[model samples]
Target: MNFKSIITSFSFTIVFAIYTINSQNTIGETEVFTTTNQAVGNITFTDTGDLVYSHHPFFSPENRVMIMDAKTKTSKPFPNKAWNTPRTTDDNYLSNVLGIRNDENGIVWMLDMAQRDHVTPKIVGWNTKTNQLERIYYLPKSVVPKHAQPNDMVVDTKNGYFIIADEGIGNGGDGTNAAFIIVDMKTGKTRRLLEGTRTTLPENTPTVINGKHLAVNGTDLLVGNDGITADANFEYIYYGPLNGTKIYRIKTLDLVNEDFTVTELDGKIETYSEKPNNGGMSIDIAGNIYLTALETNSVAVVLAKDKSVKTMVKDANMVWPDGVSYNHVDGYMYVSAAQVNKGAVFNDGKDLSTKPFYIFRFKPITKGVSFR
Candidate 1:
């Protein structure tokens, strides 16, 4: 497996320091930036659009969650004990922020699924500005049925609740129970919604990689879509099961009201799609949906009102986009190439992603609402 044979679509344009690397038999290059290296996990933006994110460090006792200037492109880990409990469910550092978002009040929140085997797996949050930890936003292990894991989340700041999607299968794609949980920011209570919808789904759509269906985990990786955000209007919540083709939504009021059944909530699914994607999902202030789809080898966008889809930028730079952010100050859109599914766990010991998982910001789509 080499570059020329496996990779068919690649970007010829080079605007920044770029290099070519092998990503699963395909040759790809990315916009290079200087930031502390730890496998970058998930990224979000402050109301001003400054870059804030977490990374998976190899040598540190704990992972780093830091802030950066998206423009100058610099980053530093947050002050220790300043961000919040770096611990997990059973009592360990809460590492890996799969999702991050800032609310209207300017609170930066994350749905952190800490590594429990290293400690206990759990979800918790911290206010970015105050650096205060809210330890109670997570669901009790007793509340989860069995072998259930909480992955990513979407905050409903107005209604005071955040919706979490369960991929069931963790990074290993095994033993995770699928379901969604709603956290009532007011009461600090959590409720479960559709968890496995994103996990149990079969790989109905295949990504073109070297003209072969890309496979991760010995089985073509599918199901358990991750990434979510509330509509800018705060009227509806938009989300996707990481691998599922459709983007779904439901009224914020309905999500927090446990009285409504998941089946009833299913009626609101909007099925937004440009193509099948298996990466982080987010929306901008104008309500545009962004997807880092490997299938298209591009970062994609969907208009909220009409469900119109467009490939924002598709060259070599867009490989395996994971998390996306909006820079309000600079007026640009950003995305990452986690090539998450390309890890050996998913790709049968073969890493299918191009080296240097990236972070990129295109000009800007300044028209509508952003769902992030």
Candidate 2:
């Protein structure tokens, strides 16, 4: 109830000013789409263009997920309050979440890390069109290790699979246990793939934001395999470590095939492109990969053809641009400025983030996969 809403009328002027000040080779006019009192972790849009996002769990928000009215811009607990509320008779609440995606079938899949309560991590898929709970896919401890933090995911409804990026930062880990969890929609079976591999592990480099190395409790923040996404046809899944410089990917067929040995799957992995330390990723119909460049406070893209990386937009206000999602209805890609480096955990217990947190949008080079 304390979340105040501000309706800014001069979005064009603000975006124009930001574009003019930044020296990067920007591609589009970045507009301040909306603001929220809490830090938004990730974003997705319904078929009707309704915005639904997760509250960054690092801040310990009361509500895990929220939906903002497309017209009124009023925010409310998504899928009702009980799903967001925890620690009662109800056992089916979202403990902690970050990754959220709206699929083509009108389903919003939320990746619940369960870090808030130290419970079993799971995926909650809600039918937005029907306003009902569709399914809950639990990742047991056997599959989700103690340090596995399932951050983002790609829902391939056409192929009946959900590939998740498990950033191994949980339970005092320093990215040594990161991996991907592949879920079979039909049988709800899960597999932890590529754990501790070179592909899933962070490089021996620190993530410097604004010229300062990002660390927590005097230890460098080493998050592995953070940003992830699949191609339009679900033929390939692209991903890389948060502190790594190379983007690697493999065929979706190779990732889910049990017959392929770990070494064989690793051999099939290709270094797709180079990227800065990033948080979220979304791909376009033309195979362009939009990445949230954390260090530069800008959005970057990996061109599908040349495999070249280019800066899309840069804004000073876009500190720690965490989650990027493309909304096909609006023809713009939305991003969340998480400002994680300013969180108390990273700054000697001093919360320095300024609010209200913002979600910005810019026109994409081409049409994107609507449900990514």
Task: Please give, for residues 134-215, the per-residue lDDT of candidate 2 as tens digits.
Answer: 9999999977888888999999897899999888988888999999899999999999999989999999779898778899
Q: How many backbone collisions does model 1 have?
A: 40
The local distance difference test score of model 1 is: 0.57
lDDT of residue 201 for candidate 2? 98
Which candidate tops TM-score?
A: 2
Model 1, stretches more than 4 Å misplaced? Answer: 1-36, 47-49, 56-64, 70-72, 79-92, 116-120, 134-136, 142-149, 171-177, 197-203, 206-208, 212-217, 268-274, 347-355, 367-371
Local distance difference test values of all predictions, in order = 0.57, 0.87
Q: Worst lDDT window (10 residues) for model 2? A: 1-10
TM-scores of all candidate predictions against the true structure: 0.76, 0.93
Checking candidate 2 for backbone clashes, the offending pairs are 225-241
Query: What value does the lDDT take at residue 227 in candidate 1?
Result: 61
